[model samples]
Target: MNTSGGAAAAGRAGNSDALEHLARVGLIALGIVHLLIAWLALQLAWGGGSGSADQSGAMATLAEQPLGKPLLWVLTVGLLALAVWQLAELTRKVPGLRSTGEERKKAVTGTVKTVAKVVVYVFLAITAFRFASGGGQSSSGQEQQTVAGVFAWPGGRFLVGIAALVLIGVGVYHVHKGVTKRFMKEIDAAQTSAGERRTIERLGQVGYPAKGVALAVVGGLLGWAAVTFDAAKASGLDGALRTLLEAPFGKALLTLVALGIAAFGVFAFFRARYPERT
Candidate 1:
């Protein structure tokens, strides 16, 4: 009767299951949002669209549809579940991995990344909740207001510059992850069929770089804003997409990007089916 091994086994088997299920549902919600964003981008690419080209626009679109509010509520729950999953991962361990020096370094890195994700997921959840509860406000306006506030703070420009660099770094990481197929680490390949793995791989390879490109442009906008002290330059994802649309060959470029984002959305479905195990 070895209690220690039994406890570890049970811990591995039981506690995270509900979290994992909720996280998968959250993945679906994420997929839907990205897909909606892509659709809006496409609309903007051609001629006209109703919503802005970002998450808020996506949520607003969702809110306008049949049973939209209920769906928003579901998404809110899902996103919060994802945030909780990230929080749990802050202390969760792979059952067999030892705490070696290298592993410890990896753990530290994972913790930092997890913390970032938790913030994102929580923010997204709040946004979804607002939309569901009819308290929704303008995401772009909120960003602008926040930027304006930061400008008033002492050494605010410096802080803004630092933020710009962080966004750029994250953008680069997303690109690297996609190009290198490093995202495979997050999926349990054993659970997927061979064709599914290939399909997922292709989707990620396209999706990540597209998403990365958008984020990098966003960071550049922030950097520009910081240097010129123009809060308007710091407009987020919606602004980023619109900026691309204005570039030469912009229509074609934006179309491709929209498709790439759609790829990411599709990839999320696969991810929901086969989640991260380690």
Candidate 2:
């Protein structure tokens, strides 16, 4: 047994752990914020209307708030950082060609993920900048501004929605690959105990579905909104949740969706702690 190889593997694992931890924490925080925003959107949508007020509107209330811009900027920066970290990890792994065919497969998967992250980060950065700047002409012939930027722009919204859908699709693929391909082999290769393998598999099974669903729902809603020129309808978590809530049986559905998202966050945290198993 080459102790040097084991030590190097351990070091790589540690670095992977740290990066995964950061990603998980960021995602969980984002989810909580999203839920809070959803609640706010709900209030604005259902609360009694003022004179000619469109209570079911997404931007109507958020546009008046001061914290919106700051929040958007924070999210934009955080997502970009995550993208960079993912890309760096992929690059580091790429140069080390493996003799094992499975190891090579994992590297390829990781590379694909890195490329996707880069694209996502670019889209998010552009959208965030557009939101920070005034987006379009207002009734007063001044640029209209919102914290999250052009909740109203069909083009931008559609692009973002497409990006989100791609992300969801990739996440689903990862779930499949992680479960059926990567982690199972790890368990076998380690000669791990059955109980440990089961635990690891369970985590993968649960976490992936939650992630897939959240991404899918978010993407679908955004895309639909874009097509209808109802970009304002899904501007934020609050707006998206409000759209669900306003549906028939929306209140109940919203509760389920919120719980699902929160569960996904928790699962993501667990996955980060045991990335090797996942």
Q: Give the best candidate by lDDT.
A: 1
Clashing pairs in 1: none
Those runs of model 1 whose alpha carbons end farther than 4 Å from true positions after fitting are 1-14, 93-101
C-alpha lDDT (0 to 100) for residue 20 of candidate 2: 51
- Best candidate per TM-score, number? 1
Q: Give per-residue CA lDDT, model 1, range 190-214, as digits (tens).
A: 9988998999999999999999998
Models 1 onward score TM values of 0.91, 0.47
* Model 1 TM: 0.91
| lDDT for each residue of candidate 2 in 1-278, tens digit (9 for 90 to 100) | 98557556644653675555655544443443333334443344456333111111222233345886665555556555556555556546655545458887777766776687667555544454445454511111111133126554556665655655775575577567545635344233255466765665665465455345445555565566556655343433334455566789876665555544444444434343443343
Runs with alpha carbons beyond 4 Å of true place in candidate 2: 1-85, 93-109, 115-161, 164-204
What residue pairs are clashing in model 2? 37-238, 38-238, 131-149
lDDT value for candidate 1? 0.86
Q: Counting only residues 3 or more apart in sequence or on different chains, how many pairs clash (N, Cα, C under 3 Å) in candidate 2? A: 3
lDDT against the true structure, per candidate, is: 0.86, 0.49
